[model samples]
Target: MKRLLVYLWTAPTTLVGLWLAPLALLTGGGVQRIDGVIEIHGGIVRRLLRRCTLLKGGASAMTLGHVVLGQDRTVLELTRAHERVHVRQAERWGPLFIPAYLLASLVALLRGKNAYFDNPFEREAYKRAP
Candidate 1:
């Protein structure tokens, strides 16, 4: 099951090009290929190239190995730590963690906290980033 989900998560951007994917670039850093997966700071994002209808604002999307974030305004802006955090969360929780992560993220947003900062997963990514 983990392998299947990993395959699904990585199929989109891996098949294409990392540059062409919906990756967030840090101020002085960018995506890097590591031993296991593409490591963006402490966050591990899956790459897949597919015809997706979940993108918003533009023709490109940077989803976190899921079908959500489609047409999401936040997803519109490509931030390094923002998306990277989701990657780490997915890594620790596996594929079934999206729903819980999304809920927590939304609650944090409603509380007027920065999603990328207040989010536990994102917090980890940011803390571990160089």
Candidate 2:
């Protein structure tokens, strides 16, 4: 099936994203499938989003392959559209998504742009969903 191929193509990246699932679960976070993606929130997901990213106050939600990590359930709901854009991007980029994403950020930084906001991927997501 075409869908199966897409899943397989993205599986490597998805596995990288899933690295945090158990940690999230053990730390009091939660996980559920929504619209064919895993959405995770609370516990360590909360702490990571609040402390570990490039944003001043941290991101409300982040998508890695088919996984979306959020500060909470409400944040997940609010950012679902935005994060879904990233999921589609992952489908397009396949296993190369992370490296390509990081490269895009680096390119933005080198060009004197805000890495997060100016990265074309983020730009696309914001344009489509914001």
Candidate 3:
């Protein structure tokens, strides 16, 4: 089935997502299955996310594999489509997505570009988001 293929393809990132699920749940947040991806919302995720200074430019959500961690429900709703693209990227890149994304940011920074906006993954997501 297509679903099975997607599950298998995203397994690596899903495994990492599993580790974050508990934290999300413990912080009063919850996870939901959306279009075959797991969306994590609410709780201390927002505070926890403050650690990612690279996201200083108003990024309110982040996608890890099949899992999405949002600052709040509203932010999640607004960005679901964009995050889904990231889920698909995770499916394609597996666990390598994180490092590859970071590398892309680093490359952009080296080029004196806005790291997040110039990163190819972000550029793709921005282009796809509605």
Candidate 4:
């Protein structure tokens, strides 16, 4: 199952590599940098779109302070705003932030709620996705 998931997630990246090679380090298309935003389109980034059912265009990623998975191109797409929320979380909590986020997600899973939506980090991410 893990392998299957990885395959499903990685297949799109192959195409992305061909398409985004020229702009790999250029930042804008392959790795865009706006006033306060950063868009990534490359091999590593393609996985974000492949894995997430909500994304589009072969998957693109962004990192405000951390990494964001922008699977699609809607305003609600997992864009910089969403990533920025995580940036805030990391800043406020310091280094223990990721572990705490993971723990909270595990708790939510144990409780049977959809962790992606119920997890506080994800909630913040989604709420700020626009």
- Output the number of the lDDT-best candidate: 2
Clashing pairs in 3: none
User: Candidate 2: misplaced stretches above 4 Å?
Assistant: none
Worst 10 residues of 2 by lDDT: 12-21
Top-TM-score structure, candidate number:
2
Q: On lDDT, who's better, 2 or 3? A: 2
Q: Write the number of the candidate with greater TM-score, choosing between 3 and 4.
A: 3
Query: What is the per-residue lDDT of model 2 for residues 8-120, given as tens digits with 9 covering 90 to 100?
Result: 99999888768788999999999999999999899898998999887899989998888999999999999999999999999999999999999999999999999899999
Candidate 2: which pairs clash? none
Candidate 3 deviant stretches above 4 angstroms: none
User: Tens-digit lDDT track for model 4 on 26-112?
Assistant: 433344444433444544345545674322443344332333334333422435566667655654554456557668878988999
Could you tell which candidate, 1 or 2, scores higher by lDDT? 2
For model 3 the TM-score comes to 0.87
Clashes of each: 10, 0, 0, 9
Ranking by lDDT: 2, 3, 4, 1
Q: Which ten residues in a row have the lowest lDDT in candidate 4?
A: 9-18
Whole-model Cα lDDT per candidate? 0.44, 0.92, 0.80, 0.50
* Model 4 vs. true fold: TM: 0.52
Q: For each candidate, what TM-score against the reference?
A: 0.39, 0.96, 0.87, 0.52
